[model samples]
Target: MALALLHTSPVHVPVFDALRDAHHPGFPLRHVVREELLAGAAARGPEAVAGEVTALVAELAAGGAAAVLCTCSTIGAVAEAAGSALAVPVLRVDRPMAAAAVRLGRVTVLATLASTLAPTRALLAEEARAAGLPGGDVRTVLVEGAWERFAAGDHDGCLDLVAAAADAVTGADVIVLAQGSMAAATARTTTALPVLSSPRPGLAAAVAAATRAAR
Candidate 1:
């Protein structure tokens, strides 16, 4: 399926690629992201961000794209607005992911990008409550310097940072990796609970929604 994806970080392209490879390798997928989406997430707030995404979705729809997936988790609220404006299926990465993660109580979200972690937690908490766990625990552990190392091409360093954050998730029933870019190289640590990352849940939703809409 063809999808026009808006994202702030370009690293997520590989993450989504990995997800497609894992779950939907039979189908061809197209992905796009701009660095501005990540760097400008805080600066423009919702209106400006939503305007940019809405514009992108409109263009992709014009070009015969099957769906729109916004890759940056932080900008999902904006994507929600854009989805309302766009004609094609617009997949916001966070909501469905939050839904799946909420099914497990005592969720821990490991995030390299600290800027997006708070919202990730809030979304998880809200979903958990709605899913029947009113007092579920949600935790966030920042893997210090993970994103920096990845951007600097120190792939090993990125993995190391993610591994280090594993300590904070020791008691979690559900461990969620908030950012998609880190999914590819995130080093695994022992977890008795379910581990939810951006790639599978988000990519699955995108593929499912796009395929269904196209059908």
Candidate 2:
């Protein structure tokens, strides 16, 4: 079955590319974006800035999509609300990352997109509760322009920014790459701690959901 993946930036293309590259026929994928969708995710409050995502998802559904997967980590609630509103499988990419991050106990989420961290935190808290794990002590460090470099194919520049972000997560047991696009440079990551990316977990869940729905 085919899937419709939506995002607001081409910066996230690497993520969906990796997902489809690994999980082919079982999860054939297509992507669409509206650049303006990311306008406030790096600045305004989550509720105020990220609202455009849900609106766009609503529009994507009218075109006969079987399920909707939102790619932006910062605008998760808007995506979550859209999922509930549409009564379809609406999987926000960060939900899986947040759920798994909390399992590592004291964890730090390295987020380059500043605007989306709040809702992403809420998703992490919810994941903690579902796991019956104690509430987590989570910290966020934002790396400015990291995604831009990665999308531009500046491999070294992306890793350098991540190395700097790593310093922010020093005390934590694990550092979760807040942006899936940033996962491309995991090899150059200097942090000794295990680094987690959003795509592996998020795509796993979306594949499971889409598979079940297709069956």
Candidate 3:
């Protein structure tokens, strides 16, 4: 199987690679990282973001990818909307995690980037509605100074900040890591609430979707 992953940060590559190796061994993976997408989304607006995602999805399909997974929460809606027009499946990496959050009732979504909060919250709402569940209370917490730590190449520090934030979250049925890059921090956190991250679940879904497409 050939799965293409669209990421807004290069940090997600190794995380996805390890997950893919452990879960879907022998599957060929193609990674496309566009750091600009994350940095420019707010200034570019939704329409521009949608256009960029649409083009990227098409490009991935043309490259013989059976499925494309968008790993950026900020552009998740755009990728999902673009999927309707493509034969190959296009999925947002956070979809499975978002749906899981809805099922858990009250979800607290944590993100290092402020841009991720709105889309992650929106996705959880959409999933809840589609599942015929009562709209759950989805809260967002932006980890202070986390993005700066990441910008400074302090990967461990950034992850520690995220895990610390997760550890402190209370009164939620689940804690959701809003970005693929945040998935690594999940292992280091000790939380009473279930903490969910995108990579493993997302790649599992991608493998399934690509398998179906191949058939």
TM-score of each: 0.86, 0.86, 0.96
In model 1, the Cα lDDT at residue 22 comes to: 82
**Model 3: per-residue Cα lDDT over 87-171, one tens digit each:** 9999998999888889878888999989888888788888999999986687899999998999899999999999999999988
What does the lDDT read for residue 21 in candidate 3?
81
Name the lDDT of candidate 3: 0.88
Name the runs in model 3 displaced over 4 angstroms: none
Question: Which scores better on lDDT, 2 or 3?
Answer: 3
How many steric overlaps are in each model, in order? 2, 1, 0
For model 2 the local lDDT of residue 215 reads 70
lDDT of 2: 0.73
Alpha-carbon error at 203 in model 1, in Å?
1.1
What digit string (tens of lDDT, one per residue) describes model 1 on residues 87-157? 68887787777898777667778887776786687788777778777735777788877878877888778
